[model samples]
Target chain A: MFVIYCPYCEEHREEEEFHASGQAHLARPLDPDNCTDKEWGDFLYFRKNPRGLHQELWQHTAGCRKFFNITRDTVSYKILETYKVGESPKVNLEDASHG
Target chain B: MDTVNVSNQYATNSVTERAEFGDSNTPVIASALEHANMKSLAVKTATGLGVTLVELPVTGMLVLRARDDKPALAAALKSSLQLDLPNVLASNVVVDNGKSYCARWIAPDEWLLSCPLQDAFEIEQNIRTAAGASSIAIVNVSGGFTTIMLSGNNANDVLKKSVTYDVHPSHFTVGKVVNTVFSKAQVTMRCLDTNHYEFIVRRSFADYVWLWLQVASAEYGISIEIE
Candidate 1:
């Protein structure tokens, strides 16, 4: 069980209160009508299954009921940093591996 | 402390409006625990015990939610009820303003406020008036949930077995509230004082929570105080 720190609630809560909403920071095409079929398919179905480090979108389902991002190590399950939505992650694959 | 009885505020309001929900004074409302029929079970459990369990006589409970503009509504609630929104989890609660109405933090943007049953409607209207066009939601959930108090020497032990959250005195204290998993269910817990903990569970989960507590506390003791 992982303990996640909610940036908004400012506390480390049990992971049971949270839900992983999939990859974070994925930008949508500016003009969806002009996008090729492949581009739309990629946006809808494509996601990174990283090995060492991963950035994930998580929602605190039980506690604060807010969405945030988590920079975690997939292999070790160590959370490097948790930031709110629209905010940047302090740790990513580059510096996250060392962390 | 959240001062001012939230119900009393409704009594003096000059709005002169009928309750949106039925007038609570004569409504035949039944709590979720009504399915469990705890009254007789409580009588049988209280024979000779150390710790005591009581279904607290709570009148009305409102789930208050606020979004982007939280402080505006919080300030309105504070002025109308004299209770500031608890800024942190498990450290501050506007419980027992010495007038029966109490409030607890459920989430950063959500709070559970309980007051007299007869005045829930008028109070809801009063809060809406106080909020004045702010984006907020006040939901009356009195029949949908209930409060239970567990007190005595082994109360903490029973809690430890039932909830995943740490119940150690060092971590949990008076006026602190937490939303955590209780076995397979969810509950909002508050520490009222030493060896005394309060639980706010949905009516649908009330029987499950009660049964879980019954089995967990059976090893130590079971005492029930029906309100």
Candidate 2:
């Protein structure tokens, strides 16, 4: 199991303390009431299943109980970085794809 | 006091009389392990005792939380408990004589303060008063948790088998506290000395944690002491 750093707790804790909540940085439509059913469904259900670097939303369930984003390599299972909610990941898929 | 009803109940039941009136009527205080009755089990299994386990008496615990750091709040806590809020996770403290509190860091904006059970209510009241108009929350959670101290030469060995965190002195030094997984439950643990560590386990899971400890310490030998 991967040990994830909790941005709030400032400690690297075991994966049991965390729950991966899927893709991160998916902003909702400005006016959801005006969106078509298909648009809403796409926003609600679709997620990126990247092979390399992936941005994920995770909650430190057993520790701080704070939600944060992590840039992890799905293949290697290496966590490049973890940032708090409302913060952006410094490591991106584009950089991993190119560099 | 429900003056009329209380008096009526007092007269009707001797149990109620003992519970309600007179200083001679001392209340029976039950520890988290009241049901387990660990003393009998420990007496049966007493051995060389490489790991020492002690369940501290019911302690007063308070959880303090605030989104933002405020100087006024810090000063207020200092004035009330003579404890400096451990802003850093590595600096949590356990003071008995001079300060009478063990301030543990729970999260970025949260802290757990432990004192004598009798002092919990007063400390909670003091923290609320100190917080004033600030957006802060202080809660009395004494009844919800209990403390267990793990010490002796093989204490670290037993901890390694039980937890994922690196308990090596090089990594987790004295005064550091962390909320992490312990067996199947989460415990707020702090290192008092190299071989000594304290765990704050929730009441419901106290028995489970103790059971885990007993099994883990089997190879190292173990002993139990009640407070």
lDDT of 2 at A95: 70
lDDT of 1 by residue, A7-90 (tens): 877878888878899998888988999999999999999999988788999998777678999988889998989998888776
Q: Candidate 2 falls in which docking quality class?
A: medium
Query: Chain A TM-score of each model, in the order shown?
Result: 0.93, 0.94
Considering summed lDDT, which 10 consecutive residues are worst modelled in model 2 chain B? B1-10
Top model number, DockQ: 1
* CAPRI level of candidate 1: medium
Q: Across residues A1-99, which tens digit of lDDT does each residue of candidate 2 receive?
A: 888888898878889889989999998988999999988998999888888998899998888778999998888988899999998678757877779
- How displaced is residue A39 in candidate 2, in Å? 2.8
Alpha carbon lDDT of residue B57, candidate 2?
86
Query: Model 2, stretches more than 4 Å misplaced?
Result: B1-29, B45-48, B94-99
TM-score of chain A of 2: 0.94
The alpha-carbon RMSD values of the candidates against the true structure, listed in the order shown, are 5.7, 5.1
Which residue pairs come into collision in candidate 2? Answer: none
